[model samples]
Target: MAIPTTNRAVVATASGPVDVLTDTELDVPTPGPLDLLVEVRAVSVNPVDVKLRGGALPGGDGPQVLGYDAAGVVLAVGDQVSAYAVGDEVYYAGSISRPGSNQQFQLVDEKVAGRKPASLDFAEAAALPLTTITAWETLFERWRLGADSTGTLLVMGAAGGVGSIMVQLARQLTGLTVIAAVGRPESREWVRELGAHHVVDRTDLLAEVTAIVPRGVDFVLSPFSAGMVETYTQVMALGGSVVAIDEPEGVDTLPLKWKSQGWHWEFMFSRVIHDPESTAHRELLDEVSRLVDAGTLRSTLGTRLSPIDAATLQEAHRLLESSATIGKVVLAAG
Candidate 1:
């Protein structure tokens, strides 16, 4: 198949609102030495995509792409690429520094991309990469919790994209008891079905959680960071660790000092932005793919929108910003 010189993409012309995302045509991106040029099949909307669209983050002089998670087929590979070749199916959460996956074609580093799971389709596979990377890094890397570690893990905002996968990974891979905090009745069941050992309402978080485990949890994964530092400190065991993926206004670390507790932040793009030698995403995604194919892990895709375009992407962004979405919302290319 001949690769086209130009491709269709959803470009954020000027960051402000969802209207900033415009469907436009641009030249296909050329891969760097360690890059793979992929024909994007499906893409998922993430909070970072909305943040980039809302002018919270910096944008380039020209229109900027905003998607992070994608599944696609390799159209070409650069000189140094060896892990993948043309025609291989792959999925990845790409670098924040580069052009994103809200396009018909994308350029991603070979070290960050992984083989797509054969058991899932493009949209299903696309939904897993970013959330899986975030969950895996938060659990095993940032928290440094091993499979043999035993204790209760309290996950705040447990039905969202990253939390959904985090609950499953912690339950399936670790001996820690999973305690998920969600507000809605449906979300409670959702987290329970995903393998949470206990479900507590966020409205009465401290009491409900303490009722289940009087001693306090050993680990806390917080995706919604607003007003959570004090609550987490009160509910954590001595020497426990808290990993947050959201940016709160500010956290009072003074309270954590008394308990000798540690606080860590997990950003999936850190490896791609800060470290050139980071191949952990590749290894992580490969392992996730194997787990998915083996049925030990499952895709967290909750909604699907048709025919990747500006209008569909706008709807996806709206859905994500509403804070009511349970899992990932994916857009399938026509």
Candidate 2:
């Protein structure tokens, strides 16, 4: 395949809100020996995407493109790439190690790319990669909850991006009773529709979860990392585990130690960013793809924007930052 000259991208040179996310053109990147060059069809706006662009990497030199989830067709492949070829429709959460999918094209490792789910459109598929990867990795890889434990698992903030998928994965893939913690009345129906066995208001997380489990939840998945550690620890059964994407602020491990419990931190980017045991990430995403294709899973994109341009992307970012979004938000390239 021939290389393209330039691609449209949302570039961030400084930190702030949607205004910081600007449009620019840059030379399309060439794939490395083990990379797949993907012509991005759709990209999802995530909190991490906003954080990285808005504040996480403040004082950066040049434009830093920010997007994690993407579904696209392969335009080219590197010499060492064996899993994909040009024109393959694929989706995957590209590694946080490099520039993101806010651009028209991106180079990602073949190991991280999976054939796009047959059931979804580009916009919908774009929403699945990042949050799905996070939920799958956190539950299966980190919490190890695929067994017929018959115990209850609590998912906090069950109406949000990662939680939306986590609820379905738990109910659809595992024998564990699924309890979803949602604060809003409006979101309760969505959580239940997603297959949550029980839905509780987040304001009364402990009481609500205890009402279902009696003892405590056997596992807790905290997608909201917004200082809910103490609440989770209180409602988690003895020896039950808690998995989080980011650490809760000012949380102490003493409570967890007393219960002989465990806390696992899942940074989905670890594999692609650091390239640590890269093959495991490949294996997990492959399984995710299979599950999605089999109809056991669904994409989490709650809203879609068009054109994949600067203005549309900026709006997506603003919406994501509001923290009120029910599910994943995506930008589609026509």
Candidate 3:
């Protein structure tokens, strides 16, 4: 299929509320060397999208296209592109430096994109990239956990998107004891279904976690770590590490010093944008594709919406902001 001259996009008029997101048309971008001009078929909403759209996070002037996760078919490839062809199906959590996947046609770097899993459709594949990359980098890259590594991995917000994949990956790939902590009792069973070794209450972090692991947890993937650093320090094992996907601002690392514990942040785009030659995102997604195809992991897509547009996107963003939905929310681009 040929690329359209003008492609549909939902652009934010300004960095404010959800109403800023409006339907618009954009010119199809020309592929550069090492670029894949993808025909975006599916997209997934994320908390970052909400943050950027709602002025919680600052972006460039005027309206901006907001998306991270996408599954699409390659319409064309740049002359220098080597790994993918015109018809190849690919998935990626695109670079924050570029225009996002909220458009019909978009260009993504070949090194950052991966082959979509054959067992999953575009929507399912779309749900994986952003959250998968975040979780994989947090567990494997940031924490430096290997296949042979064995310890207690505490997924602080285990029912959410990143934690969902992190729990499954830790269970399937590593020899670690995975403890999925949910804020509510209702989410306990959901986390168990994702193969968490233990489902504990995240609300009662200190008492509940201590009851289960008397020695304290070895690693923690915390979603909200701003004011809980002291409590987390108590729950962590000696020399253990904690990683947060969200802003860990206002957090004093002093408490961790006594225990020789560490607190780190994991943003998936950092490696791709800063280190241009990095192939970690693609490699992670490729391994994730193999895992999904082999029935080792499952798609975390929870609510599937339809016909990618401003209204659908606004709803998706709203849902993510509520923090009530479990797993991921994906929108079909048809």
Candidate 4:
């Protein structure tokens, strides 16, 4: 198949409402020295996509393509690319700095792309990469959980996409006890099925977690870091740390001082956009592919949409914004 001169894409300009999201055609981008021109087959909506669409997370003053998680086929590779070929299947959470995977064709660095899991199709594969990379980086890189790492890990947002995969990763890769924080009755059994050693209501995180651990949790992945800092300080063990995925601006470190505790942040795109030389993203994705193929990990896709257009994308943005979505919502790309 010959590559088209113009690429079909969904683009946003200022980002006020879902109506701002529109379908259009743009030039097919040329790959850089280490980039891959991927024909995106499927994409999943993320919280960041919603944020970016609402102008909460601002992008360049150009046509912003709001997507990150992608499962696609490689149509071409840059001169320096070695790990993948033209016809290979791949998946990745593309960099925040470039045009995103919502387009028909997008340029992603080879170091940020990995082979799609053999066990899953495009929509399922799309559901994993962003959340998988986020969970992997948070567990292994930030908190340094390993075979020798024996302690309690309390995941505050445990039923969501990242939390779902994080539970499985911690259970399979380390010796730590995973405490999944879920308020709804619907999610309790689900988290347990995903390998959570303990389940607690998020309404009273401190009381429920204390009853389970009794000695305080070693690490936590709390979403709203600023408001929960004081409560987290009380529930955390001495020298323990909290890894947050949201805004850290109002999070005062004063509470962590008494116990010698720490508060860290994990944004999966930090390395890809800022430190382009790191192969950690690709390596982690490949490792997770092995896990998925081996039946140790699973896709967290909750809903599926089709044909990747403006109205469908608007619906995706609305669903994610509601904050009640159990898992990831994916779309079949053109």
RMSD of 4: 1.5
lDDT by residue for model 2 (112-139), tens = 8888877789998888877887888887
Candidate 2's C-alpha runs over 4 A off are 273-277
The lDDT values for all models are 0.90, 0.82, 0.89, 0.88
Local lDDT at 60 for model 2: 70
Candidate 4 lDDT trough over 10 residues, lowest sum: 55-64
Best by lDDT: 1
Clashes of 3: 0
Tens-digit lDDT track of model 1 for 1-334: 5789989999998878889889999899888899999999999999888987887555555488878999999999999998998999999998877888999999999999999999999999999999899999998989777889789999988999998999999999999999999989889878988999999999999899899988889999988878778888889888888999988886776788889998999988888788878888898999999999999999999999989999999999999989889989999998
Model 3 Cα lDDT, one tens digit per residue, 1-334: 7777998998988888888999999889999999999999999998888888877434666577889899999999999999999899999999887889999999999999999999999999999998998888887789888899999999988989999999999999899999988877777888899999988887787888898899899999988877888988899999989898888557788889999999898988788768999887788899999999999999999889999999999899889888788899999976
Per-model TM against the reference:
0.97, 0.94, 0.97, 0.95
**Candidate 1, which ten residues in sequence have the lowest lDDT sum?**
55-64
Q: Write the per-residue lDDT of candidate 4 for residues 1-334, one digit (tens) a residue.
A: 4677989899887667888898999899998889899999999998888878887545655468889999999998889999998989999998877888889999999998889998899999999998888888899889877877899999987988889888999998899999999879888977999999999998988899999888799999877566788998989999989989877576677888999999888988888778889998899899889989999898988889998888899999899887777778999864
Q: Where does model 4 exceed 4 Å of error?
A: 56-58
| Candidate with better TM-score, 1 vs 4 | 1
Per-prediction RMSD in angstroms? 1.2, 1.8, 1.3, 1.5
In terms of lDDT, model 2 sits at: 0.82
Query: How much is the lDDT of residue 181 in candidate 1?
Result: 93
